[model samples]
Target: MSSTRLLVIQPSRTNPPAALAEWLRDAGAELDVVLASEQPLPASLDGYAGVVCLGGEMSALDDLRHPWLASVRKLLAEAVTRNVPTLAICLGAQLLAAATGGVVRPMEDGPEVGGRLVAKRDSVGTDPLFADLPWTPDVLQFHSDEISSLPAGAQLLASSPRCQNQAFLVGTCAYGVQFHIETTTETVLEWAAADPEAAERAPRGGFTRDGLDQLHEDLAETWKPFAQRFVRLAEEGPRPNGSLGRNLPLV
Candidate 1:
């Protein structure tokens, strides 16, 4: 509603942040976590400064199995309409895409799992959250379905060779990322245990514990600052450069 608290929606158990929680707290933001897998969403986005939706095992379109997904999508749409700052990751991102007129289907080249690199687009240089990131930042890939297209007027932020729409900004403050920036080695193991079939389908260099740890080291160094900036955005309200604002309509 009218507080500095952020709504952290965990759609699944395995997607909790191993390091992101501390990072956000350190950046002067308080989080109100919602285990969406077990509970319904709030009646409105009125109490939170922002929303953060985590990844999950189910598809964005699988409302039949996880019926609450429909409510989650409606909340995400409400976030955009109200200009609430939002960060949707992996399955969350796919749901955001589908809610905003984008497409999400199985990747033609198979799942992009494990450590991977995504290059920042030219517009990222001026982007409030992604401006300071490296040209090609390391991120964990743990999804089979990819965002084939973006919502209307969505700004493309990062991309890899495998996935064309790796990260994007929809509306003013609602961001969706196809990659996992909030994972740890333990997180990966938990996800793997949940979906053992992904191990057989993983790319040659992926699925190793040691490799995953090494990749997490790199991701921590890079994405932690991004998370901090997001917290700052939530703390400071809208920016002058149009990175955030309730009045700024999506073009």
Candidate 2:
């Protein structure tokens, strides 16, 4: 529908879903951005056609410092329960995991930063968001915490050696990605500049701004279509009863 609208929850000032928003717009979905860092989330997922939660520097557990995160998590849980299409990235992924009875913790090996490849699992063949991806797709990793366990009934769609829960599907419409598909060279540079120590320890080897540019180009080749697919799913909207459908238990 030409009038379709999606809600984008930006949790951190530095970490916005830059390219993802662009791709969604190109796919014909209008966006209503909410800076959760500054404003309150609506009480429910009543109006939006879809929800997209972006990454941040904070741990998904740091609700004391960022009190709004709890509300965001509640909204995500609602999105899953209502069968609303959702895309959760990085910290957003961890939040989705935690909200849905999954486990999120600091990685034993520390952060996974910069460009890396995650292998697709066989289950991806049936996942609407991940079905057409390459066997190993390049993605940006910038978080220290990992999803050690998935929610019960969550379908694993992809993994990397360091992170078993790289990507997964919860219920029928909610998706979570441990790695980022929305980063740009400038975004990576800003993040790297903000945390030089982590930048030095990036697992894909320390990334240069130029290297990130190339990697982002590679990422765009694959993820743009994936984003468009998500938009198409949003266009489908919720069921006639305004429920996400009776697919799977969200939690």
Candidate 3:
């Protein structure tokens, strides 16, 4: 009777700093949310079919500033080792890369914001995630840093002008998107309100706080479908017997 449970390891308020909760609800997921900002990530990361690590201001490499970040990285590493599917966004993506020997670098050109088109690269035919979506998906973007390289044995899927390593397939099934496809306009305004720097650094012609909040209802409806697309990608992970679990309704 219940759907696949998603353990979201976010490093913000329980209500969340991202629209992750809203989008996951729309994806037909049963979210078992745990804010790493509130509690350290549980050591045992099993029991869930999927995991989602949401973005935050904290860098994955900065243990001195945020010790919980290091613990979360370990949790992510363990999750992948067990073949548990995951979707890592922004800092979470960087963490996935770093957990597998990749590096996160500050942008030479600075933060990328607003909506941008992501072109499907070599993964055009192979990757289940972007295979069905448009060849050039107009996805939301936000981030100052970028991943320089992928984790060992990863495949590049999609990219933008500002970030070359925009999306990647780690080993199999697990995917990471640098851009925030799940971000609703409410999340955008929340970030701008809480972090004044975000308002100033947003891409040219992007919205201010009031304008961002006003777009919440419209963006909320638009982002959910894209987030569900990601859910299907994760559900593609191989099972112990070489078969996947049943798909949940992503209506």
Candidate 4:
């Protein structure tokens, strides 16, 4: 049998898949990355085992400025409707929420930047992708806008004091996370330099080279296995009962 092929939609040049691409490939899935800013999104999800939409520098509502986002949103909606295993990160998460009737707006408290922890909700006890995560897993936050409300029928899976809609599940297999589990230190530093205001909002000492190195180390511990589990889910596909197969081992 061929390896599982996942469609990775990159909404921004700055926020490439980075470490997430390595994790997915390490988990044995073949990736086809579509830089949405430079190319068209696939009209259908056909022949793709899963979809992974990465974060972007733009707001989810910036369709006029970045028209390709409209196509990305459409594909995401179709992913949910078809029950394809999907993971949407950061701005991608906001887009997922917006595309599915949830609301997105500028965070009133200001941008959430740097490495932080988000507590897992009880609903994750049975979620195929989140059940195995640590109680309060380490994550990287660097977004100005927030998913103020989740899409109807979406299951809230994780949250933090700063952002309520940190992670959520749509339908059976679509997952959206408001944090960054995929950034390398270099990727974040570049972001910081480009958006100094947002970088300044980061918690004091959050952007040091040592700090970022340790942050990625912590992320690899928690999210690398999570990525593998996602690849397994993609490989297994949806079950006859219209569910993503088997809950992840909770231990």
Query: Which candidate's lDDT is highest?
Result: 4
TM-score of 3: 0.82
Candidate 2 off by > 4 Å: 203-205, 239-251
Instruction: Please write out the lDDT profile of model 2 over residues 117-212, one tens digit for every residue.
Output: 999999877666788889999998888899999988888899998889999887788899999999878888899888888887875558787788
Q: How accurate is candidate 2 locally (lDDT)?
A: 0.86
Residue-level lDDT for 40 in candidate 3: 55
Better of 1 and 4 by lDDT: 4
- Model 1 TM-score? 0.90
- For each candidate in the order shown, give its overall lDDT on alpha carbons: 0.82, 0.86, 0.69, 0.88
Model 4 clash pairs are: none
Query: What is residue 125's positional error in candidate 4, in angstroms?
Result: 1.7
* lDDT tens digits by residue: candidate 4, 47-135: 99999999999999787899888888888887877788999999989888887778999999889998888999998887778888889
List TM-scores for all candidates, in order. Answer: 0.90, 0.93, 0.82, 0.94
Decreasing lDDT order of the candidates: 4, 2, 1, 3
True-structure lDDT of candidate 3: 0.69
- Per TM-score, what order, best first? 4, 2, 1, 3
Worst 10 residues of 3 by lDDT: 242-251
Candidate 4 local lDDT, residue 20:
93
RMSD of each: 3.4, 2.7, 6.0, 5.1
Per-residue error for 2 in candidate 4, Å, reads 1.2
